[model samples]
Target: MVYREMETDAEMAMFVKCFWMSDSQNDEGIHTVLPDGYFDLIFYRIDNNLNRIFLTGTWTIPVDVPFTKNTSHFGIRFKLIASEYIFRESIERIIDTSTNLPLHYWNVSDETFENLETFSIEMGRIIERFIPDYTEIDRRKFSLMGCLYDNHGDISVAELSERVGWSSRQINRWFNNQFGLPLKTFANILKCHHAYRQIAQGRFIPESAYYDQAHFIKEIKRYTGYTPKELFELKNDRFLQLSTHDNG
Candidate 1:
């Protein structure tokens, strides 16, 4: 397994988290992908030619992906708000699904798509052509999202309402319309991601985010479908480990 990640350039950082690629020839069997409140554009190839292009939407549960021999994957991990710029359709249509991408949806020239070498470089070009100017984005919403991220999804709805000067109902409606989930659900996903990072690093503390040990275990299980111990003890968990490292 050769897994690596590169930070997005300044221009693309507003909507993209990073560019990641993996080349694994081993028979690692089934690898589970955990929910992390983000979307991904994945390109998989078996022997250098594109085998499939998938656009994955936000997930609230774990997904299992089977590894194949001599397969390589390149992906663009998009930020939470990226769907607003990348897709014209409602996000609710794609939640928890990996939809195949039509060639027309790529918004790139056929020659450019065929010549895709480095995903990071090619993604930058695609984003440059499709995304609107950054200044056009809602700065207030972006700032509120930053606050939520900085706190690792620990903030309350009332507090967020006050901070954003919007009613809780309004915020929930907007989030549902754009993200296909309520604000609280999105926050819980982020919290789970944060907790997973702590667990992956062997530094989890019960009191860090939960009321009690039982609550911690239940929440972890709710998001990941596995107890912390089982998740940690799994040996063929390269995808889980990579998601934790990259998303953290």
Candidate 2:
């Protein structure tokens, strides 16, 4: 498989993490996708022809996705705030799964997948049209999310609430309603995602947030079904993200 990614600019950074594309080589295979606490809007194709478009909800655990020979995918990975200001709908119903979106949802065409650079620019325009006014975003929610990403989900729920000036009860309720998961679960996913990046870079040690090595191992296994060492080994390309990360 061949994979590539492009980072978003500052203007779109608050709503999008990155734009990525993947191509299945000449053989059918399974791609193990790890949880990164982000949702996606995917445009899938076969033989370079637009097949379909779909929206994915936030993932809490790894999912194995199968691809046919010569298939390709282009996707936009979104932050939490996009649900309110960009997509403007609740994703709670699709948690851990995805639903097919109308092919014309974004007026997507076969031309949109022609190249990553063009796709990235086009998506920025699309997202901007969805939220012409930046103030449509809630200040407290924006601050809370910024802090979470900055700290890699290291802060506690209470501290997050106090920092954002929002109550914990309200925060949890909002999380559950929007993402079908609590704040801590999402935070843990982000924390585990950071650990994956470290492991991919050939670092085997646990992060400082874990109580100890054993605690870190358990948490890694819980979300990724592999200990840090196993993930680092990269046997048979079991983890697709780590396998293609450098290629990206």
Candidate 3:
């Protein structure tokens, strides 16, 4: 198994976290995928032929994926704010689902779709053509997201509402409309991600974001479907480990 990733171009850095590709010639069996609070546009291939192109939605629970030998995959990991530009409808409609990207979704040419190697090389240009102009983004909401991220999701809804000059209800409405989850849920996912990194690094201190040991365990289980000990003991979860490292 080989996994490679590159940071998004400067122009797209605000919306995209990174672009990644993975190739594996060995049978990896079933891999567990944990919730990471973001969505991805994924391209899959086997034996160098296009297999699928789809958009994965935000997830609140773990998912299992089976990997066969000689598989290759490429993907764009989008920041939460990019939901408006990537999806045609309310994100709430696609939570915990994978929707095939129709022709109209990206308006990409068939030639581009058929030739993934070339497409991967020119991904930045292809993405730029489909991405909405940066000026069109809602700066207020973007800033609010930044505040949450900067605080590692430890900020309260009331504090977020005050900072954004929106009521808690309005903030949650926006969160649901854009990311398919409430503000509190999204924050919890973010908190879990932070805990995941700590655990991955072999440091499992109780962080400020967690109310107590029980709360930490609950959030970990909610996102990963495993307790901290179980997840750490998992030896067949290479995909999950790789994904977590790339996200970090």
TM-score leader: 2
Pairs of colliding residues, candidate 2: none
Model 1 weakest lDDT span, ten residues long: 107-116
Tens digits of per-residue lDDT for model 2 on 54-141? 9999988888998889899999999988898888888999999999988788887676788888888888788888864855668998
In order, how many clashes per candidate? 0, 0, 0
Model 3: per-residue lDDT, tens digit, 1-248?
66666776677776677777767678667776677767888887788666788888887888887788988777888777777764445667778988886534455444553333555546777667767766876667777888877777889988888887888898888888777789988898888876776677545567898888888887788788777767666733543553455335
What lDDT score goes with residue 91 in model 3? 66
Clashing pairs in 3: none
lDDT of each: 0.74, 0.85, 0.73
Lowest lDDT 10-residue stretch of candidate 2: 239-248
Find the candidate with the highest lDDT and give its number: 2
Positional deviation of 138 in candidate 3, in angstroms? 1.8
Error of 1 at 1 (Å): 3.0
Q: What TM-score does each of the candidates earn? A: 0.87, 0.95, 0.86
Q: Tell me which of candidates 2 and 3 scores higher on TM-score.
A: 2
TM-score of 2: 0.95
- Using TM-score as the measure, name the better of candidate 1 and candidate 3: 1
